[model samples]
Target: MNGGAVLLPYRSNRPWLSGRDRKRIAQVLVLVLLVLVAAAVPQGPAWAGANLIANPGLERVDVGGFPVCWEKSGWGDQSFTFGLTGPGHTGANAMQITLATSPNGDRKAMMLENPSCAPNVTPGHQYDLSVWYTTTTANTVMTMFRHDVAQGWVYWTDLATLAVTPAWTQKTVRTPQVPADTDQIAWGVTIYGVGTLKTDDYAMEDVTAPATGTACSAGDACVKGVWQVLPFNSPVRGLHTVVLKNGNVLLVAGSGNDPDAFAAGTFTTAVYQPTTGTFINVPTPADLFCAGHVQLPDGRVLIMGGNKAYPAADGSHGYEGLKDSYVFDPATNSYSRVNDMTAGSWYPSATVLGNGDVISLGGLGEDSSGTVATQYFSQAQQRWLGLGEAHQTWNFWGLYPSMILMQDGRLFYTGSHVFGNGLPGTGSSIYDYDANTITPVSGLQNKDQRDQSMSVLLPPAQDQKVITMGGGNIDSNPDANRLTDVIDLKQANPTYTAGPLLPTGTLTGGIPQTTHQGKMYVSAVLLPDGKVFETGGGLHNRADPVYEASMYDPATNTFTAGMAVDPVPRTYHSSAFLLPDGRVMAVGDNPGNGSFDMRLSVYSPPYLFKGARPQILGLSSAEWAYGSTRVVTVDGPILKAELIRPEAVTHSSDPNQRFVDLPMSVSGNTIGLNLTSNPNIAPPGWYMLFVVGTNGVPSVAQWVHVG
Candidate 1:
């Protein structure tokens, strides 16, 4: 609100006013008060805007269970109630929207909207939307949308992110110039996180402010970073995406997004060109919804396991694990069937071992008890090597457990997963792939976080830290947990302690009065600069409510807002990874009632917005040994050099994507970089080589194999 809060006088004896009288007086008083107090209104335009809402108060209840003159849609989850009995911010009645149980592991179940009757507005006018609200639980966000007849109701902006506070505070949402192509303007509000929120008075009108100042124009905001959406569309929804060694993107979504294609196991694949906005069709052998993927030492991608079929009668899928596997040959942009696993697997986690084989673990198996049997694909023999059965008691690591190979050749579990269909496997664990045994890791404060929580092998893999962020319960009334914890797996007693708070995104054009949205399903891609670009996640109530990407800085242990915003809403089953050119490709947005987004978006980081991107002039070899120093040349001043393990992501968790900082000494355009012999840090496979400049810019990646 431009003016200070007005404490409406309490008349005690004669406090009850007719609904009509109450709205009229409130509008008049507020307009007069704003004109007197707002000294910053722009000078060019005369203040002539009026309250466009039909009713500002909730005193008049309609037969349709909404306030008079207002219309609403969605599940029966809203009400206009009166006074202390109602939980309003003022007088007799206030509007309340409730969060209901969700329909699936990755679907939004609530949609309570209240819209104005298409208010008339002027062209080139700016407006402010204000409301007084308080909530019972944290991170309950209010959203607004603009109804474009052609595009339907598109998200216009977010107003505020409220926490669990008792006081009624006023929040404002200021929108840019109103579109001149629209016939009328309408706004609506809804709650995304958990809990209920009460609202009383509301207002929407034009205000004035000075436009002159030290303003930021084009080329200014790119000093740090920026995001620009490309002009082309990805042919297939990027349910599964990987950056190929050839600087192209390999996208996989087996199942042409037919309503029943996922259950029936459809195969649809393509290769996306980052340089040109075009897609080349590639075919897959089977649907890879719950499959595991890893880049091979020979620069191929091993795609293991996926959906077989789930009978439609049961309503909820039992996740029929598949015994089939395939290897994607980037050389031909095609897939080849490989040896099947010892047992059928769905949603398995795969990681490349020190010797070039892949250790595959967890996920629903043929018998569906978390598949006690484990297996590894021998790249040397082109056959499946059975590892016997894994930890029997801890088989419920759920799907895609945070399994990564350690420096000691042991597998460490971060106790996070894509699904929590059963009792969650709590705490971190160390598994000896040889002994087929498990040892509980101590000091982890956040256990039972197996439901879509994200765990990553932190930057400069040598650090040996696994950071896990945001997850929630599988139970009906689920809410996302904003817990960011890190554990030093190298420690004698590796335990997860608190790390930096996960970065929070603001509601579009809104204030920071509340924490916006939950943190489940946040996807991270390790950039060449050693920072993690994270975005897309579920809300507290299972809704995917975020579009703004954030970059995680390891040096300062904080996050800076992504310079660009992606328009797509990528929720559960979505994937993001850094392209060889330093751009980010985001895909997959599964909303569970059989809705899958086949559309994908790419994010050109701020570096792309600057001058011509730096170039990796040359490298001695594409392959390097465990411990060796190599000479590389760049076209620009080299600030740092890093090796990022190429990642294959599914269900928001990528077993790869670790950052290994190369010890570097620069000499003009030439640089010498050192590689560590520790397989636990660098692993044995191909990585994306990047050279960062002092200007915070990065060179396009080149393929570098570490063994």
Candidate 2:
């Protein structure tokens, strides 16, 4: 001992070892205890975080130098290198990016983006970013670029500069609270001069914190999900509406009653995302004005026909027809130009076929009536083919007519249609897709009663009943037809029989009028609740635009006034559709040509505020085949199931919207349903699948593909 202190021995009763030995033994015991404690405690994602980016190792390259599921900047300011020297963080290969100053005098920037693939990094989320990098210089600015759902691009505020070391180093940058709307995830690396940056094993992981919100109450109603007038109004009128499987509404107005918009080549396509309450402006490859669209089997939209821009002087004879077709792929969020159709079709109508093809017909062709030829878009060939002209017996294809695929692989044209003449040629018939033959529908008492009327296939579609409701001819002329017709195709012999008439809309019209007859140009939509919603229609085309709305209950075979009367007039070009959120969206009401107005109105059904709403929490598949059995998980009671065809509305024509009741049996919290094998019952394409609770409240829809 240096000073007065003496070396003290460890006071241990055991004499198995010397003082030094006892001390060493105690040290070993402490180490062992730490290891056991660590092993016993559960290690979750927060502890051993994994990379969220696909192909993170950069080991899998698809022909190009870039990795799969990654979008790279190809603007020459960015260059990528593969197969780096030595071992990468995870594999033999590593990716490198070098930036040189661009001619614009800015540092080169590159972003590796995976869009919409990543869930929103909402506010309650905390993320830690880890990456291995070897750069030629230090202080290279790296940034996290987030594509916000509402706002376009938002940065992390501060640039996370990588502190370069002499050798490769693993570095971690903890991000601040992730914004609520952060949707598309991207990482950007910016460099100055001729600097090279090698990157490997980049990871961004979510670290959850303690719950900070209210607990689920025993009785919270479903109307919490109510009608939200999307934060931004659509730039273009939603004349043609298609509900995308991803829950976004694809609104294509084309020219929007502006004939000059066609010649100007105005890009009138836009998409509204419900999640972020924002609108994304998408460029259109062609004018989709007055085009016919349907969701194809592969989840792509087959949009055929467009405005050739030939407005006639009389307004009744404008016949600018287009034959070109286009396909919008939701996967890429881009449109693909497809070949033209066999013949020109204007104000055309389309319906899905059992064979996964779409048969398009009827438009004011050069003849100013239904187009002569019946054209079908072949999914296999990805082009339109002629099924020859309409059967000589079939004439006067109205503007925006009603065509439905029947249970027997035949396509039925409900003699009822929106425009043109109101009888025979406008009459009902069945056409066989296999034989390419036409079979006329029979037992019709009032042949001309269907002009401008709407027809819908009753729910649980197995019944195969078609209901044709009120409309007028001439000037939407003669007064709206009060008599509603019901034709059951499955009945040994189908005929139009008096079912029920729409309640006098004028009863609720602010102006007291003597006539109780409904107006012409009514738009009908099949609700998830198995009821039919009828909106819009003027007493005489606009002399009396009925603002009141009515709902037809199939169970009661009666029409009852809706809880809320629409403030916006939906007379002529007026369109309404069932939104994925269970509310009804009524848009576009240009009572006449060039008078198109873009006042969008959303109506929340009585079911919304009725009681606690139901929720279709989880869907097993984004895509499923017809007759396929699916297990659906719900958060509430489901007494009935429905699959509504995604809609595309214009005039009185909605190419989509075939409401078919899905065969479902609820066992516990799971719903077991069989997708109808019959394509007519449900066509091959994306549909808004909903489950109705015992209280008549419907679950917010989950899009299901039934091909």
Candidate 3:
């Protein structure tokens, strides 16, 4: 075997090793190497032939429900990507998806075309389908279909039917079966419905598989079952504020009156995954008001300033706030000191900036009375940098100064005041972060937007809308009292002609008017579908309606009747991530302890539609044989046409003709078409021909046959 020569025994009777034998051996070795390389590759968009289809090399029929995924680590799209761009559209702001029927009633789902996936899927082996989805009717069913050549029509051959839930859910579907004797595949999705399907995004990518599925199971058990809440024994006596991080929930609440001492505790924050639900104590350096807490992107929480318990003889402990900060890390299950703020304050507002830092607004500083001093934390510096002085000082209270970041990178601060010494008096100014300036804009809306209220940006449509929920004046000013006004902030944009008020109302009639100091109050969360959930505000009930929750749908611009769910009346609590699975965890917030109330609860959104739920039609077992025949007939007007193949095509006659629908549109254009074969679908000799037409009337059908 020296110098790459064959070392075989010298057998005079054997025929000489021919060139053909060497070529065959080489071919086998190359194939073995290819398989070895493929197996070593991680599953996802990065892998070759990592098309939307699963088992790409094997040429299997993926069918719907086979679990198409985008590796979580990939930078770009893996399956499919859609850009809804044209004249007048604001790039691609938000998207929704629905399964509906064409005017003639044919099943259809939305599709996104990616130039990258097209090369991998043209005329053959794998295809992609995806949507930006939200639900209005809870039980709406969305399905995926394929063009079957065997029968000369489109059918639900590879179905991925999804049920419409109140919140938005993103879906991806792929078909792996490829036709033999071809190198091209055509693909499209349709939502079978009569009503319009609203979607903000549509995409497709050449991906291997997702790292993990975001949901588990079906029905209410799927959403409601993933969470469990750990209740406080003393019930966070006067629970006031709540925040979530990692899988742990943190609360800065008060308990046991006297000097009105505040306490703290922890729960869970793991989003949609099933959590063990444990309750732990958050040790405070001193007994004080746990005014506000914000989570840093690196997972550390900045526990802000608050007043101490028992008026410190000279009224210092009871009235003054503490700037001593603590950072709680779930990784180690412990709290450590982080750098403290420049000023000791209470009733401060903290907003997470786009760069991952937090900008803390003013509140009552060391004087025990409120002051408008502003400071922001620079993660790099691990210290707070003063943002000069607030527009107003000692004017804003430590409660209900709303801070919400818009997608455009602007921090909108709506309510603060201008008392004689910078303590909260009464003012409504809109601040611009880029310029670090505040300009007062007044239709004189909710001056009481301070405590026991919440605000969220409606999924920024091209239109750009923002909503402000409940707040009241706690007798500070006679005109400012407990309110329930749904103010539309969209009208007050930097540049905007007055659009309609998009529906408006208040929660006045049936709720009560308690002491109104209104600590530990919360507002609502924006659902993927443009609806919002208003939860954990003050005790506003006909028969003590405090611990109640309701939903506000932007489509109709109205709030639903409230439901009792909060274990205790929560104010100053926090809820993040309306999980695609439809469950929201609310942590922090005590009854009014001004501190010690550390409690946690889970708020699940309502099911929008009710009926027999549609199941995720799993992948079918049938495979299409290659070199099979397909015959397509046009019964109506020609319009445009397209031919969709099951997977990528390797070789075939006129692969372009596969997309037959795009070119054939006339008053009565009828054509008979032939689909050839490809090696990708070896063993099998057929392909699924999916088609869509818009001859004036829309038509979608598929057929399966030999080419």
Candidate 4:
């Protein structure tokens, strides 16, 4: 109708349209308008979600010269200054915080505590929180606080530990399900060290709905796997975790990084039975914290060296190592004293040789200097070798070095270690115990920054390849690197070559992330499927927990990203190992804040959710010699078999851990597995023998002794 005029019929005094006709016309016009609006708007689920944060750009400031709806918060005795800065991630302003002397505390710029500024959240829903930032410090965490209706604003869990970003970079993390009675949340980036931090463009969106269908799928659990945080907490701090032959987990917490505990002699140990979900406390004999441990041929755990004394509070003296050693008999759940080492050792590397003896190397001595004496443990005599018998290389291998046992009986140090600048030479070397010589290996990138990095012997053991992944320097306080280096010891001149980068989580603004913001304290567990499940780590020395994980397939030398992430922050002292049921269990996290997280989380690989798991009906024998053939009776057809050496992991180093592939010839439900002839490949120890079905599912492991 032009000019809003209603036309009338020629013979009628009434309007041109009837009542019903007018109504139909109005409906048609409404439909057309809606179609136009829909066309102008974005389509699909992309338009459904939105950022819930208010004053996210930090452009609006109050009279106090701080970002409106955000506040400066911190604790402990620290000197800091907070204000607004220019050239924000998106707007003209960003928040800035400087810590001049953060000896005991931390600082952050967080959302205001009031209801109007906080982001409203639905209980049980997850939100993706992201922020753009630049920081001179390596220690930062995405801290959160929740509004509890009755208790006002209360502290929530920290989401992710952010990497050091000298340049403008986006850090994103997904929160766990909102706890009940929580109506809103506030978050901020925290700087816990002496440095400067600038942050802007904060975003929080409800990702619960979309994640329900995509983050993890009921149909795709076999590919994505699933992580579940257990309901109960571990009784011990779990600084050291060993998968016992009886299928129980031995948790050792000697002193547990607690100076007060060391003073009080409150060392602790516990045996956790996964099947029953029960714990049996064991009386610890010494302060076994920072000790070296490995499984003996008879299945006893040899624990050596630990904190003999704590460092002085005023820095006059450093931590002293202990020469005391003990053997834990799982059968009795007790520790028995053994002969002391030649020198005190803290954070030593223990490797079990093919002959069943152990070589203990590296670590700080009683004087707090690197111990140069290479100690030997004679399994037959059950005593440490005397000084005359000990090999004195006079070389410090650094703390908790990843000393892998090669086929030729030489030890290969992967250059992956914890704390301090890397040693002289190439940062990696081959040590011949008999000749008392150390030959440096080359091509380990950024070796000094490899503190708490992980080194894994890629399965099958016959391949003789090791991969070192992600590390940072805690003492120097540098940004962690996402460098993966692989070395083929089988080569004539074995050297490290760059491997795939560690997978990272999502970023904000569709910004292209060129490299993986690497992390330290990463735990790599070898799964029955022949893939390594790499989980939990931190960015700084032991502070910012990195939330990245993946499945590394050795067969293809590639990483399958997008695996389920463990919700718990696994940083310093965290450990992960494969369980007998084919799942992976992660435990322990001691952040720099002096807090210990006893929470334990278990990850069930995608193979578990695929089809029916293969069953081991019977076995010809429980003992197999090298090169022997054993018959395994299964309930269904099996495609392959493997013998995985049980894990005795601590400080992310387990040189004794390896997977020996058992070549199998299957006929119906009967399978004949040919064990490896090489003792160095299989080692002399108890192993978890697993049979895989044609459907890719593995059976509950059966315990077998290999010698």
| Candidate that scores best on lDDT | 4
lDDT score at residue 593, model 4, on the 0-100 scale:
83
Could you tell me the TM-score of candidate 1?
0.65
Quote the positional error of residue 245 for candidate 2 in Å: 1.1
Q: Which residue runs of candidate 4 sit more than 4 Å off their true CA positions?
A: 1-217, 506-516
lDDT of each: 0.65, 0.64, 0.38, 0.81
Give per-model TM-scores: 0.65, 0.64, 0.46, 0.68
RMSD in Å for candidate 3, one decimal? 24.1
Candidate 4 residue-wise lDDT, 140-209, digit = tens: 7677889988878867644545556788998655554566778888899888888899999988766544
Find the candidate with the highest TM-score and give its number: 4
Q: For residues 598-636, could you state the per-residue lDDT of candidate 2 as single tens digits?
A: 666777766776656688777788777654557788886
Q: Model 3's lDDT to the true fold?
A: 0.38
lDDT, candidate 2, residue 330? 75
Better of 2 and 4 by TM-score: 4
lDDT of 3 at 290: 36
- The better candidate by TM-score, 1 or 4, is 4
Model 3 C-alpha lDDT per residue in residues 1-707, reported as the tens digit of each score: 01011111211113555767756654553454345334432332233333343222221111121111111010221132222222111232332233332343333322211221222333222334445455453223333333333532222322233445444455544433233333322233333343333343344343323233333334653322223464533233322322233333344343333342233422212211225544555444543343556655454555566554335666544456667666656566556776667777665666655455566676666766555666677766766765453222423434435555543555555443212111233334555666656555443344543333444444322123444444443444222223333334434444212212212222334443344422114445544233456565443211122444565655345556434355543443333333222345554433233343344455544332221222212212223222122223554322222232221100000010011111111212233232212221111122223322221112322323232
Candidates in descending lDDT order: 4, 1, 2, 3
lDDT of each residue in 1-707, candidate 1, tens digit only:
52212312311112467777766666665565455334322233234455555455555443234554344334433332222235466677677655544232111111222222345454445566666777775535444455555655555433334446578876554443444443345554454444566676766676423332322244644644444445566677677778777777788777633537765556788888777767899867787766788888888888888777653566555657787889888889988887788877788888888888887777777655566566778878977875443332335556787787787888888777766542334477888877767888765544654477777887767667777777765564355656677787767878777776655554434323145335677787888766777777765434544555677765456677644656676776777788887878777777756566666667766666555567888898888876565779888655567898777887777877798867553455776676765577777777888887655578878888788
